[model samples]
Target chain A: MGRPSAGKSTLASHVEDQLVEAGYPIENLDGDDIRKHLHPDLGFSREDRRTNNRRTAYIAKLLNRNDIPVIVGMITPFRDSQEQARDIIEDEGEFVQIYVKCSVEAAEERDPKGLYQQAREKNIEKFTGVNHPFQEPLNPEIIVDTEAQSIDDCVDDVMTQLETLGVLDERLDDDYSFSITRSEEQDITERLEELGYLEE
Target chain B: MGRPSAGKSTLASHVEDQLVEAGYPIENLDGDDIRKHLHPDLGFSREDRRTNNRRTAYIAKLLNRNDIPVIVGMITPFRDSQEQARDIIEDEGEFVQIYVKCSVEAAEERDPKGLYQQAREKNIEKFTGVNHPFQEPLNPEIIVDTEAQSIDDCVDDVMTQLETLGVLDERLDDDYSFSITRSEEQDITERLEELGYLEE
Candidate 1:
C-alpha cells in the first residue's frame, strides 16, 4: 500500500502477471477496481476507507484460502486499517506489506488520474497525500522507492523480496524484459496508463 | 442459484470440497457470506438484491479470470440479475448455470434457516421463493433436483454435467464418499443445518 500515483498499481500488476505466468492462481486487486465494482457506495472518509480495506482483506483471505494469491494495491492511508487488513489476511495465509514509496511532489508530478491536481484545487475531498494524510507503515515487510527506481526495477525488487521470503520458487523468477532503458520504459508505462491498463 | 433451503450451499460445499481435493484452485461464493463481508449495508430490497447479485457476479468474474473457478450459490431471484451475471462472467470465462431444483414445498418443509416460517409470519420482506418470486432459468447448463436426489447424487450429477460440458477433464473425476444411505445423509444434513452450515 502507498500514496496515490506511487506506482502501486503498476508494480502490483507486473507482479500479478509474473505470478500468473508462473502457473500460480493469482489476481490483482486495485482500490480503483474494488471501488468501481464492490464498494461503489463507499466514500473517501477514514471510516469508509477502513470498511473498504476490511472488505478487500476479507476477499483476499477467501482467495488465499483457495490457493490463490493476490497482489492488492490500495492507498490504505490509515495505520489502523492496514493493521486490520494484515490481521484478517495473515490469519488465513500470508500478508506481506510492501511499501511503494514516493514523495508527494513526485506523485503529483506523475498524476496519472489528475487526482492530485484535483485535490490541490479542492475538487476532491479526502485525497490521500494531498488533502489527507498517508501514514507510512511503521514496519513494512518490503519497501520499494518508486521515486528513485524504475517501475521494472521496483517490480524486480518486490519479486526478489518474495523469493527471499520463499513465497516464490527460484524457477518462478520472472525475466521482466529489462532490456529497455528508463526512458523507453517510462514511454511504455505512460502509453499503458493512458490506455487504462495501469489504473483508472 | 436456487431458492433458500434448496440445498444450494450444501451441494456447493460438497462440489468445492471435491474440486479442492482434486488439487483445483477454486472457492465457494455464497450469498450469505458475501452479504456478511462485502454487502453489509445492503438490505433485502429487490434493488438491493440486484446490486448484491451483480457485485457477486463481478467478483466471480475476477476470480475466474485469475484461473480460479468459483462455485457461487446465491438466491438470484430475478432473471435480469442472472442474465447480468452471465453477461459479465461469460466475457472472461465459462459460465455454466446449475439450477438446483426443488419445489417450494420441499424447501419450506426443510426450512434450514427457518426463513420460510419467518416469511410466512410476515417477519421478513422480499424473501425469495416466499414473498418474492424466483424466476427459473430458461435454459440452465445443469439441473439437480434436491428433493428427489441424495446430496451425493446431486454432487455426482453436477460433476457429470461439468465433465460432459468439457469444463473438467475426465481424469479429474472425483471419487466421493458415498458410504451412507439417504437416511443417514439426511440425519447429517439436519445436524449441519442446525449448526448453520446449510444456510443462515
Candidate 2:
C-alpha cells in the first residue's frame, strides 16, 4: 500500500512476473483491474477508500487460504484502513506491507494518469495527497523510495525483501529478464505510462 | 447452478467439507455468502442476476488459475449467463456444471426462507422461478434430483461425478462424515434450514 502514483502498480506487476517465471504460485491483483472489475462503485472519499482496502484484502485472504500468495497495489491513504487490511489478510497468511515512497512533487511531476493535474487544477474532491491526507505507513515491512530509484530498482528491492522474509526460496532465484536494464526498458516504460499503464 | 431452494447451497457446502477433509485444494463460494459479501447492491432483476453470475465466475477463474478448484452455487437464471460463466472459468480450468434439479412445487413445499410464500402472496417483483424465469441447464456435466433424493445422496452423486471427471484421485477418496446418514444429519439439516441456512 502506498500513495497515489507512488509506483505501486508498476513495481507490483514486475515483481509478480519475476516470481511467476520461477514457478511460484503467485498472483498480481493490479489496481487498475480491481478498479475496473470489482469496486467500480467506490469513490475517493475516506470511507470508500477503507471499503476498497477491506475488499481487496478479503480477496487476498481467499487466495492465501489456497496457498497462493498475492501482490496487491492499492493507494491506501488512511492508517485505519491499512490496519484493517493487515488484520484481514494476516488471518490467512503473512501480510507484508511494502511502502512505495514518492514525494508529492515527484509524483505530480510523473503524473501518469493526469490525476494530479486534475486534482490541482479542477480541485477534485477527496483527492489523496491533494485535498485529502495520505497517512504514512506505521510499520512497513519493506520500503522502496520510488523518487530516488528507477522502476526496476524498486521491483528488485521488493523481490529481495520477499526473499529475506522467506517468502521466496533462494535456490529458485535467477537472472530474471525484468532485472536487466535496457534502453527499451526505460523508453517503453515511459510510453506505457503515457498510455495509462500503471497509472494506479 | 440451480434454481432458488433447489438444495444447491446445502449440497455444495457438504461436498466442500468432504473434499477438504481429504486435503484437496478446493474452495466453496456459497450463494448466500456471495450475496452477503460481494454484491449487496445487486437486486433480483434479470440483468443483476447475470452480473452476479459473471462476477462469481471471474473469482472462480482467479482461483482456478492458481490450481485451486472452486465450487460456486449460484442461481444463474439465464442460459447466456451460464454460458458466459463457463467460458470465463474454462479459460483457466475445467468448468463443471452441476444442476440440482427440484420441481417448483417441491421447492415451494420445502421453502425454508418463506420466499415462496412471499412470492405467491405478496408478489415480490422479479423473484426467480416465480416472476423471473430460471432457464434449465442445456448440458450439465452432472444432474442430481434433490426432490427425489436426500441431501446426502445429492452430495455423493457430485463426488462420484467429480471422480469420474478425473478431478479427484481415487487413492485420496475416503468415507467422509458428511456421507454418513446420522440422525443428526437429517434433524440438524432441517433445523438449520429453518434458521435460514441454505435459503439461497
Model 1 Cα displacement at B29 (Å)?
A: 1.9
| Model 1 agreement with the true structure over A76-167: per-residue lDDT tens digits | 99999889999989988889999999999999999999988888889998889877889999999999999999998988888778867767
Report how far residue B114 has shifted in candidate 2, in Å. Answer: 3.6
True contacts kept of 2: 0.45
What is the Cα-based TM-score of model 1?
A: 0.80
Q: Indicate the residue-level lDDT of A184 in model 1.
A: 46
**Positional deviation of B121 in candidate 1, in angstroms?**
1.7
Tens digits of per-residue lDDT, candidate 1, B48-70, equal 99999998888888778766789
- Alpha carbon lDDT at B10, candidate 2: 90
Residues B91-145, candidate 2: write the lDDT tens digits: 9888999999999999999889989999998668887888889999899999999
Candidate 1 off by > 4 Å: A17-25, A170-200, B20-23, B170-200
